[model samples]
Target: MHQQSAGQLPAEVLAAFQDEQQQLDAAGIPAGVATVGSVMPDGDLLDAHGEPTTLTAARNGRPAVVVFYRGAWCPYCNIALRAYQEQLQPALATRGVALVAISPQTPDGSLTMQQTKELTFTVLSDAGNQIARRLGILTAPTEPVRQAQAALGLDLTTVNADHTPALPMPAVALVDTAGVLRWIDVHPNYATRTEPAAVLAALTTLD
Candidate 1:
């Protein structure tokens, strides 16, 4: 996926991105990450309009496929989200499941991502990645990668709601109406994501 834009990036920036991917692959999923049967944590979030909301509110008593992505500035995130909107959303709707995508980006950024992707599902802003932290899916770019991102005109400080470089490892969690996590897939490597098919298959296991 990075190859698509590699030609456009400086050599050093591309190398930095590769190094980050290697480190993530070696580290694997973080220890103590939320597992199936655990209660999914609810946290304060901002809707695309910047209105206060919560994970439970967005779920509205329905089973939900909760997505945690880096932000609108991430090309891989955009691709994954667009795929979810097109493929996963309709399938989830048929099963009475809600699809919600959360990011640490500001409300405006969330709004832009939804608008740009023409997404119909709920998009929320986790001001400080409160839910992500509790789920143990938190990650941040390495220093070299951060510098590379800056070279590409991406600034996490201004792009993120918390004004920090923190981000969630791209993840998908299936939560039943009871707030129990049915399944979870975490990708420490930012370039990879939970495929729509994988998420739908997991939904079949939910009671």
Candidate 2:
């Protein structure tokens, strides 16, 4: 196993998910790689409409930004998405960087979101939490959320359009043209996330 260090995340995130299982217990917040390394078996995911869009297709020989969010139901997720749509996209494009927002939301849901948020970049769906699971960041929801989701008909599997019934990490990863990770921002609290200005700063490292 790699000797994971705190530098993969900020001090706050490090405190949240030091051990793998501790991250699983944290509600709202999803834990991911607090330490960075080359991705494994990276591949495509179904878009909001259920079309497969691969990671290789998305992050080709160009600097790219990938943002992962819970479904659109989360208010904080909405804030982060809108912030990227309205502010982060333009700022990053200026630096020749591409931005993509990924979620397990269904294609119809993603379309509605695109219209609602006026997002201009690619929005891929990791239905079944396939992408998250492959990345080793998918988490099972706490019982309370499972019950609430069932009551509200917010089944993530349906939202994802697949069999994956788990939650995913709330984070953003920056990769340069060569598909190398330069920075990753993760939050343990679902109510919070990395800000747009900080995301832009990360893009600067690609320069």
Compute each candidate's TM-score over C-alphas: 0.97, 0.76
Model 1 Cα lDDT, one tens digit per residue, 1-207: 666778788889999999999999999999979988999998989998899999999999999999999988888988898899889999999999999999999988765534655989999999999999999998889999999998988999999999999999999999999999999999999889999999988977785
Off by over 4 Å in 2: 1-34, 111-117
For every candidate in turn, the CA RMSD to the true structure comes to 1.2, 9.2
lDDT values, one for every candidate? 0.91, 0.66
Once model 2 is optimally superposed onto the true structure by TM-score, how far is the C-alpha of residue 186 displaced, in angstroms?
A: 1.2
Best by lDDT: 1
lDDT of 2 by residue, 1-207 (tens): 113434443454334333443544354333445345465225558654567777657765667888878777655677678778888888777777888777777767754645455777777776666656666566656555555556655676666556566666787888777777788876655556788888877766766
Candidate 1 global lDDT: 0.91
Question: How good is model 1 by TM-score?
Answer: 0.97
| Model 1: residue 202 alpha-carbon error in angstroms | 0.4
Clashes of 1: 0
Span of ten consecutive residues with least summed lDDT in model 1: 108-117
Give one clash count per candidate, in the order shown: 0, 4
